[model samples]
Target: MKAEKDKIVSLHYTLTDDGGVTLDSSRGREPLSYLHGHGNIIRGLEAALEGNEAGFSSSVQVVPADGYGEYNPQAVFEVPREQFPPNETIQVGMQVQGESPDGVLNFTVLAVNEKGVVLDANHPMAGKNLNFEVEVLEVRDATAQELSHGHVHPHGHDH
Candidate 1:
């Protein structure tokens, strides 16, 4: 089978940045599986995998716009220290979640001080080009449940 819409594609991938630093990998772990053409992975990688069959291997470069998206300066701001839980220690690089008009927003603490904490809402990888070394391990028709859920469901699992 080939990777296409509604199909389940399993692959082992090593993701790196333009600097060639590995950001993630599936080696030594169970192959990652996702429903193809369902926004389950980065757009560029997904597009590149289209029509590929099991055992296909390739290196794909994805721009920031197609990967995590360009960094937004407006996403960085300072919030008063009191906004965080009183018992929690605010530290740089800590991930924090808060309610926003659109929904819950996750931000990374860039700095901490007496008055406020600086947080950046951009994804950690935002603005960086992503390079992926991928090997497709399996391709098969997605189960009806998996299609309905918009994700892959492993055997004997409810979610």
Candidate 2:
């Protein structure tokens, strides 16, 4: 079957940055599987894989907007140190999570000082181009259960 909405696609991919630094990959592990057109993957990658069938292989470049989105300065803010666990030692570059009105937000620590802690909610990959070398290993129609769940289940449904 071709990769389209509701189709499950299994693929091996090596993700890299513009400078060719490897970021992530499925080389030594099982191929990643996801339901097509379900937003399970990035927009640019889904667009590139659209209408393709199994056995397809290609290198795709995804801009920031299509990948993680351009970094928004508004997402960076400072919060009083008391917001975090008093016992926790906050450090720069460490990832943390905060509860917001919308939902839980993941943030990276930008700076920590006596005044407050600076956190950036933007994804770590935001504002950067992503390079993907992908090989589609298999493609098939998603089962009714998979479609209902909006994602692929590599193992039998246990959730």
Candidate 3:
């Protein structure tokens, strides 16, 4: 059946950044399944899936405004390294939750120094265009429980 509101749609997708680096993919594995028009995927991709059918393959580019969002310089800051537990092996690429001017936020450790640490709060993919290659694998009516739960229910699921 054609994908539409409340339908359960399964698709294999490869999500990449503007740099053409693979960010995520559904291959050699189960196709991602979710209730159509249920905010189960990125807005741009979800909109593109509307009215599509099984075996439909296409590519879509999602802008920061629609994907994650632009990077805010104000979100990155250097803070006293002492705040983190000593001997914790502070290292680049590690993630640490910290309190920011706005609220608690997740920050990726960009650098570490005796004076402080560099934290970037922007999403790893923020400020970039996201490219998505999608192939619809299946589309069928969603079970009542799937609609109620706002997700796809496995075959013969209790719900």
Clashes of each: 0, 0, 0
Writing each residue's lDDT as its tens digit, candidate 2 over 1-159 gives: 889999999999999999999999999999999999999999999999999988999999999999999989999999999888889999999999988799998999999998789999999999999999999999998998898888899986757
Error of 2 at 146 (Å): 0.3
Which candidate comes out best when scored by lDDT? 2
Cα lDDT for residue 109, candidate 2: 98
The digit string of per-residue lDDT tens for model 1 on 12-43 reads 99998888999999999999999999998999
Tens-digit lDDT track for model 3 on 109-147? 999989999999899878889899999999999887887
- TM-scores for every candidate against the unseen true structure: 0.96, 0.97, 0.86
Off by over 4 Å in 3: 99-104, 155-159
Whole-model Cα lDDT per candidate? 0.93, 0.95, 0.87
The local lDDT score (0 to 100) that residue 102 gets in candidate 1 is 100
Better of 1 and 2 by lDDT: 2
* Cα deviation of 29, candidate 1, in Å: 0.2
> Which residue pairs clash in candidate 2?
none
